[model samples]
Every structure is written in structure tokens, then in C-alpha cells.
Target: MSVVTLIGAGQMASALTFPLFENGHEVRLVGSPLDDAVIDRLREDNYHVNLRRTLHDGINYIKCADVKEAIKGADLIVCGISSFGVEWFADEILPILDESIPLISVTKGMLDYEDGTMQTYPEYWQEKLPEGSKLRLYAIGGPCTARDLSDHDPSFVAYCGPDFETLEWIRSLFSTDYYIISLTKDVVGLECAVALKNGYALGTALAIGIKEKLGDDGIDHNNMKSALFQESVKEMLELLRIVGGGVDNIMFAAGDLDVTVSAGRSRTVGLLLGKGYTIEETLEQLQGQTLEAVVIATRTARAVKALAKAGKVSIDDFPLLMHVDGLLNEHATLNIPWKKFERHM
Candidate 1:
């Protein structure tokens, strides 16, 4: 059995191990030094609290107790860290990793830099690696959630990267009867779709929150939500064009991922806002949790505005995007301009 080293002990990291073990792979999980308590709990209880599943017998817990030792002689690497932590973990493990081994990143989100450039995780990681490194980098995105994967519920995900051979091989290792895989060479489109959907899906969540607040009985506002979904897809298509990615590729990234976010925690942020929670109050409710939707929405809005100022993109092309950006970052109201969207219908 091939030994796979998973760097990060978060919910996704723990849940993803199930598929690896199912494929007859030995998993070595390396959590952050800060996650010692979680590691201890997993070891003692023989279960991952976040995943709510008993530990697979083939899995080995390596509590950042020895970073190098944890990763030694692994056949493959998978990073399931949060967007904020991916770079830190990359820095720690890059030196210990051989250039030949492939690193698949399940972390999704754009990295907003002080320089006013927003980059995908793969681009950020590639820039961080030492010069002349040939490390194969891959990314996973789309509708699959950790809970579903851990529970062996049917799931589908998109895999994209520059190395087709390695990507396909990694695909073979993870794809099960329950977990389906789709491949794409359009990394920019896929990564941007994955990251941008969280920001755009906030609008749909706002609609859900408003529906719940109105206490509407027997009146499914699927039309209203469909409108928000269309707006999100339109904005995502515009973004893909501006960033030199194909519009059709958005179906794989934005279309699939937006549906997932609508049904997941990413929607919770917008729901709180719709329920009349102030930004501060909402953040307080989400204390100690990293809401990538809120973070990405705020950062990407600024990044897009910056890109517009530089004349790289047309600001007027993204009204919904700008509106949501203002709502998330500038403390603007939850008002949406329905008049501006008549042409879309």
C-alpha cells in the first residue's frame, strides 16, 4: 500500500483520509504543532471529533511532533489546511519534500496580498517554492464536502493542475464508488471558480435568510434564489474572461461549487447578515472559525477594485460583485438593485 502524508488535521483533512484508506493507502496525518490537543484526542479516542467517525485502521496520526519524521518516505502528499494556513504549512514541508513527489491541495481560496494582487492557492504556492523546483501541484474543488466524503455519501469533485499524468494518478488513488472525479487542465478557471463561488453564494444565502425571516409558508422562493444563482454565474463568467480563463470552464468550477456553498456553511454568513446581524455580531457568532466566504468576499472585492483602478478590468462589468463586496467590507446594507437585473431575465 502506498503511504500518503496529509498535512493538516482539520475537518476536511480528517474526512478525506477515509477515501485514501478505502483505496488501500496508508495515511500519515501531520497536524500543526498547535493541534496537539486534537491529535491527542484522536489518538486516545480512536476517532476524529470533527469528522464524527471512528479512525480508519490504516491511518497514522503524526502530531507535528516531528514534522520531518511525519513526512519521511511518503509516496504522496495532500494538503487540506485552511487558506490562511496553507502557505505556512507549505514553507514547513517544502524543504523536507522531494521535487518528484506531487502535492495535492484541497484548500480553496484566493490569497490577497498587500501588493493588491489576488492569487489562487496553486499560484501562491508555486511562487513560494524555491527556484528551479519541479514539484507537481494539483488542486481539488467543486461540490464535495468533508462530511459527505467521510460518511461515504456519493460525491463528485474536480481535479486540475499542470501535470496531467500525476493528476490522473492521484485521481486513481482517491476515486471510489462513492467519490467520483472529473479532470480539467484549466487550473485558472477551476481555482477561480472554487474561490469566487464562496463570495457570490453569499447573496443567495441572504435570500434564504430573508425568506426565513418573512416566515413565508408554502411559498418556495426558488425563483428569487435562481436569480441570485444566475447573477453569481454571470459575475463568475465575467471574472473568468478578465483573468484569461474560458467562460465554459466556469460550469465546472462556479456552477458546481456555488450549489455546494448554497447548501453549506458559506451560506451561513449571509444568513446571519440577512437575519439582521451586524458584521461585528456575525463575526462574534463565528468566533474562532475561519469563514472563507467572508474573508474571500472582503479581500476579492478590494482586489477587483484595485484591478479596475489599474484599468485591467472594467468595474461596471460586475455590479452584483461590487454590491456584495460593499455589503461585506464597507458595511453597506443588504439592498440588491432588482432594477439593474431586469435585462438578465
Candidate 2:
């Protein structure tokens, strides 16, 4: 059995300990500086504070102060923090990291540069490592959620890396009967696909909010939702093309979109926007919760705007995404822009 040291006790990270521990790995879950409360909860009882679920027993819980010692002799390292923890992980973990140990991130999002360029988390992390470091970077993307994985639901996802052979090795460690794993060498495509799902999922979910605003709990606006879903896949494919990723990567993109449109913080924010809440009001409603969809939507809109200026992509090509971004950042009201979608068709 391998010793798998995870660096964050986040929902997805903590849920992951179940499969790994069940698979006979020695899983050490180290809490980030932000996860002290959750770590204490896990220590008190296996109950996870944020996830609202009990985790598997026999997993070791290490505090933030002991992260160094917790990672000792780790056969594999899981970068389980969210995007907000990227810099912190670099500053606190990278310096002491063993370059030979491979790392896989469940973190989803891309970093936007001053020039409006975007790079996936793994790419950004790779650049921050010491020159000539042997650390291999990998990320998982798909529809796996914290609650579902915690219950050992049959969730399918892709473990994406630069090398196919190594990804198979990673698959061997985490794949279970309930948690099926697929491998992809298209890192950019896989990362972009999953990150794009967050924004598009929010966009697709606006119909629910719209239906609620229409004062009809009995009627489902699945028609509008399905249209948004299709347009999302189309735009996602174009985004991948511009970024030099395989268009076929839409498999993960569409599947993630399907799952995300109905659940998570993305849907929550989208519902708020559809109910006519201002971004400030919506954010207040989500106080203390992370909105990955809003973060990626606004950042991707800015990046794509730069691309549109460069004639790499048309700003008009992403109506749902741009509309969602406006609702989040521009003080714009909730308008579906069905006209823009028609033009796209």
C-alpha cells in the first residue's frame, strides 16, 4: 500500500480519502491554514463540517502546522486545495516538496494574467517549481462532486496529465467500482473543459431562476436549459480550439456541464441571478462559500475578450458565458440574450 499525503481537507479532498483508504492506501489528510475548523471536526468525530458527511475512519488527520512531517515518505501527493490556495501551496508546500514525488490536483480553474492570458493550475504550478525539478503534475476533471463521492456513488472522471502511461498509474490508485476513472493526455483540453463547465453550468442554470421568477414551481424550463446546454458545448469546443486542445475533449466538458447545471455553488449563484439579485446581493447570500463558477466566468470573459480583440475568437461567439459574466461583474441585469444565441445558431 502506498502512502498518499493530501495537502487540503477541503470537501473534495476529504471525500477522496474514502476511496483511497478503501483501496488500501495510507491516506494522510493535512489541513490547510484555512481548514483548521474542519480538521478539528474530523478529529472530534469523522464528521466533515463543510461536507455535512462522515468520512472513512483510519485516515490520519494532520494539522496545518505539521504539514511538513505529514508529507514525509509520501508515495504520492494530492494538491487538494481550491484556486484561492494556489499561491499559499506554492509558498508553503512547493519549497519543501520532494521533486521526485508525483502530484495530482483536484483544484479546478485557470489563472488569468495581466495581458488577459490564461493558464491552467497545473501549468502555473509547474512554472513555480524549482528549475529542473522532477515533479510531475496531473489534474482530475469531470462530474465527481463531494457528496456523491463521499457516499461512494458511481462517478466517472478523467485523470489528465501530460503523459498517458503515468496517468494510468494514477488511475490504478484511485479508481474503484463506484468511482470510475478515465485517462487523457490532453491537459489543456481537459482542464479547460472542466473549468468552462463551471461558468456554462451557471449560465445553463439561469433558466431555473427564471422559472422561479415566473412564479411557477410546477413548470420546468427544461427547454431553455437544454438550449443553453447545447450552446455551452459549442462554445466550449471553440474555446478548446483556440487554446490548442482537442475538440473531442468536449466529452468531459458536456458531461461536467450536465452534472454541474443541476448542482453546486454555480447553480446556487445562477438561481440568485435569475431571481434578479444583484451581484453584490448574490455574493452576500453566498458569504463564506466559494463561487468557482463566478470566478472562472468573469476571468474567462476577460481572457476571451482579449482573444476577440486579437481576432482569435469572436466575443459574440460566447453569448451565455458573456451574459453570465455581465450579471456577475458588470451590474447588468438578467437578460438571456436569446437573440445572440440565435445568431450563434
Candidate 3:
């Protein structure tokens, strides 16, 4: 059993604590200044207000106020922050961090620089660490959701990093009978797929909603939706290739596109749109919830468009992604250009 320090106190963060505790690890959850109330409540009551769950009893679960104290002698550091918070978090903890500690991120999103350079969360964090540092960074991706994992449901995810040997060690540390871990060295491809999947899940939801609205009870539009699903994968692979990544990472679920698409938060927003709700109405409905797909859609679109302008990738290469971006950000109509889509490319 090793001591693990988890950063952030959101649903994903809270959900993770259970498995670690069950697997006989000493866990310390550290909250940012923004999470003062969350830490205070969790500290006093042994329950997290946001997660609406009590901490598992009979475990050495500790919550710390300061980052330095939380990670003082941690065997591993897991960042549960959202993509938007990673940069600030990196800056906050870098001054006190041990460069040799292994870092794993469950965050899935892309970073876009002002100059239009785009990198995945792990890549961005790796860059933010001191130059020539020994910090090994990894990211988890695939269909594992927080709620499912919180309930101890059987789940699997792709554990990706630079080396298989180190990743295997990480996998063993995090794995439980109910929580399965697979390995990959396709960090770029995995991160890109994870970052981009929420956007595509919204598309899948929209397709499902439109089919139901059209009175197809059989969900027989599986054919049409499957096309949309494959189109999403093609666009993902193209985006990966454009950004110097390989497409072989998608091999396991090669025939089952739905397996790769997680039931993400953005699907709710897309379902609303597919059910004929306006963009204003959708945003109004999702007022309190963090719509990560919305953020990724806008940011990734800007990054991809910048790449297109620089001739790194053509705008035509990602019609579905760009179309969904317009639908999300510009209040554009749901109508997409299906004719321009490449079915087998």
C-alpha cells in the first residue's frame, strides 16, 4: 500500500477515493482555494457536499489544506482537476513538487495557445513542469465515468504514458477487481481521443434525439447514427494524424464505435438540441453544471481552425467536428453536410 495524493474535490476526484481506499492505499485529498468550503464540509462531516456521499468508513483517508503538506511524501500524485484548472494547478504545486514523483491525470481536455498551438492536458502539464524534469506524466481515457466508478461498478480505461513498464506499475497501483486498467503508449492518440470524444458524444446524442423526434421508436436509425459515429472516429484519427499521432490506439473497439463513446456530460446538452431546444434554452438549462463539451468544442475548434489556416490540416478534414462546434458556439442550425463526409477514409 502506497500513499497517494489526489488533487481536486469534484465528482471525479471523490469517486476515485473509494477505490484507492478499498485497495489499501493511504489517500490524502487536497483541495484548491476555490474548494475551501468543500474541504471544510468534508473535513467536519466526513461527507462531501458536492458528491452527496459519505467517505468510506474504516480507512485512513485524510484531507489536507495545503498542496505542499498533501504531497509531502506521496508515492504517486493523481490530478483530478478539470483541463481548465491544470495550468493554474501546475503553477501552484510546481514550486514544492518533487520532480521524480509520478503524475497521472484523469482530466480530459485540450490546451490552445494564443499562437494556435494545441496540446492535450498531459502534454501541457509536462511542458509546464521544469525543463529536463523526471516527472512521468500519464492520462487515463475511455468509457470509465465517475458515477459508475463511485458505485464500484465494473469499469475499464486506457492507461497511457511514455513507457509500458512504468505504466504497468501505475496500473497495478490503481487497479481493483471492479476497476480494470489496460495499457497503451499512445499518449497523444489516447489524449486526443479522450478530449475529442465528449464533442462526438454530443453528436451521437443529437443523432439519437433527432431519430426519436422523427418517430423512429426502434432506434433503427442505428444505421445513420453508426455512420455519424464512424465519421467521428475518422475525424478523430485525422486530427491525431495531423498532430503527429497514430490511429492504431482505437484497435480494440474497432467494430464497436459505441463502446468508445462514453456517456459524457455534454450528451445532455446535445440531446436537448436534438429534441429541438434552442442554444439559449440549452445553456439556460445547463446553468449550474459544467458543460466541458461546450468548452472543448469552442477551444478545439479555434485550435483546429488555426491549424487549417497554417496548412497543417484542411478545414474539410473535420466537417462533423466543425459543424458541431458551430452548433454549440454560433447557434447554427443542426443541419450538417453529410455529402462532404468521407465514409471510409
Candidate 4:
């Protein structure tokens, strides 16, 4: 059994920990003081997950104060931290990690400050690692939610990277009665798809919320909203293309099918925002924390506009690009006419 060290005790981390423990792997969970409180609650309550109504049946708790101590002898290191925490983690923890251990990131969303300059998660981590350190990095993406996994719902997740053997090993480790793990070499595509989907989800949510506000109005707002969502999905895919990601990434991001525009937690957050609730207000109302998509949609919209201005992409191909830009910039009055957007039908 591999000794796995999971850094971050968030919902996602907690959801996955049960599977690792059940599979007989030794799990060492390292967390901040706040995260430690979450762990304490889990242990005191006999390990309850909101996602799953079932209770865990094993010794799943192994808390560590420092990341170095948590991962010192670990065979694999899983990072489920939020995107915002990644840089701090790389600075404070990655340097202490042994080069031999493989690192798997379950986080999604790009570093806005990095722009498209940093293409993939592995590349970002590699830049932080010491030169000549042979560290294998892999990314897990697809539509598997923490809620589904916590409740032992049958789910599939893709593990992809340049290291084929390592990817296969990870696939094997995660494959269980309820969890199916697929391996791939399209690491960049996979990561890009994961990041871009957040923006699409948010944009779709906003469109839906707007449609609700325009009830019985002259515009066939529901139909227009649906088209807007579809167009946004296509636009996001195009943006990913400019960044060198594959069409397969879209399939993975959409959960191997055409996902409804109003799907996922991030989209729900967007809907709330569209209903005149500020970001902070939406967060307070959400049953759980919102993903980076709410902010990412805005950042990516700016970056895409910059790239478009630079002649790096075709503006005509991404009509909704400007609309997303308008939404993100809080530009209530857009230069583009509303009737022109409706004409796309």
C-alpha cells in the first residue's frame, strides 16, 4: 500500500480520503489551523461527509502540522488545495518534498496573474521545484464532484500527464468499486479544459439569471439564454484552442456529454450573482464555497481580449467573447448591440 500525503483538508480532500483509506493506503493529511478544525469535526462526528450520508469504517485520520512531515516518507503526494493557495504551497512546501515522490494536483483553474504564459499545472510546479529535481507531476480532471465521491456514487475521473507509467500507476491506485480512473497523455489539454470550464459555467449561470429577470419580455429570453450558453461553451473551447488545448478537453469538461448550462456549483454561484447579489453575498448564500470560476471568468475574458487585440485569435469566431468581457468588467452598457447578439439565431 502506498503511503499518500494529501495537502489540504478541504471538502475535496475529505471526499477522496475515504477511498484511499478503504483501499488500505496510509493517508497523512496536512492542513492549516482552520482545516484542522474541519478534521477535528470529522473525527469527533465519526467522519461525516455532507456529500455522502454514509459513515466511514476505518482509521482514516492522520493529521500533521507541517507539510514536510506529512510528505517526508510519502510515496505519492496529492494536492487538493485551492488555486489561490498553490503559489504559497509551492513556496512553503514543494521545496521540502523529495524529488522521487510523484505529485498529483486535483485543483482546477488557471493562475490569473500567470496568464497563458504558464500553460499547464506541471509547468507551473516545475518552475517552482529546484532545478534538476526529477519530480513527476500529474493532473486529475473531468466531472467528478466531491459530493458524488463522498457519497460513494459511481464516478469516473481522468488522470493525464507526460509520464505514462506514472499515470497508469495513479489510475490503478484510484480505481475502485465506485471510482473509475482513466489515464491520458494530454496533460495540457486536460488542465486547460478544466480551467476553461469554470468560466463557461459562470457565464452560463449569468445568462440564465438574466433570462429569469426578463420574464414575459419581448425577447424570447429563455431561448436566447440557451443559445448564449451554447455559444459561450463554444467560445471557451475556441479560447482553449488558441492556448493549444484539444477538443477532447471539452468532452471531458462537459462530463463526456452535453452538460446543461445550469450545472455545477460554480454555475449556481453565477446565477446568484446575476440575481443582483454581489460575489460576497452569493458566497454567504451558497451551501458550499464557490470555485475560482466566478473570478476566472473575468480574468480570462480580459486575457482573451488582449490576445484578440494582438491578432493572436480570430475575433469573429468568438462573438460572446466580448459579451463575457462586458459582464466581467461590470460594463452594464456594452458597445455591442443586444439585437445583434439575438441575430445569431
Point to the candidate with the largest TM-score. 2
Q: Which of 1 and 3 is ahead in lDDT?
A: 1
> lDDT for model 1, on a 0 to 1 scale?
0.79
Q: RMSD per prediction, one decimal?
A: 1.9, 1.4, 2.7, 3.6
Clashes of 3: 0
Residue pairs in clash, model 1: none
Alpha carbon lDDT of each predicted model = 0.79, 0.88, 0.76, 0.68
In model 4, the clashing pairs are none
Model 3: colliding residue pairs: none
- Lowest lDDT sum, 10 consecutive residues, model 1, at 336-345
Predicted candidate 4 versus true structure: per-residue lDDT over 1-345, tens digit per residue: 988888877667767776887888887666644466656666676454434333365534545466666776788988877777777778877887787889898877665443434256566888788879898888888777777787788877788877789888877667789988877888878887777777676666676666565566677666655665667667767766777777777777666223424366667765765665655566688746646775667667666666667777655665565555555556443222334444343
State how far residue 173 of model 1 sits from its true place (Å): 1.0
For candidate 1, the C-alpha RMSD (Å) to the true structure equals 1.9
Candidate 1 residue-wise lDDT, 229-263, digit = tens = 78778778877776667677777656565665556
Count clashing pairs, candidate 2.
Answer: 0
Model 2 CA lDDT for position 93:
92
> What ranges in model 4 sit over 4 Å off?
48-64, 112-118, 211-225, 256-264, 276-291, 333-345
Kindly list the per-residue Cα lDDT of model 2 for residues 1-345, writing each as its tens digit.
999999999999998998899999999999999889889889888899888999888889989999989989998899999888999988789889888888999999987765667889989888998989989999999998989999988999999887888888888888889999888888999998998889988888888788888995677678877888888888898888877789878999999998887689999898888889998998999999989999999889999988888776778888888888888888998888887877623
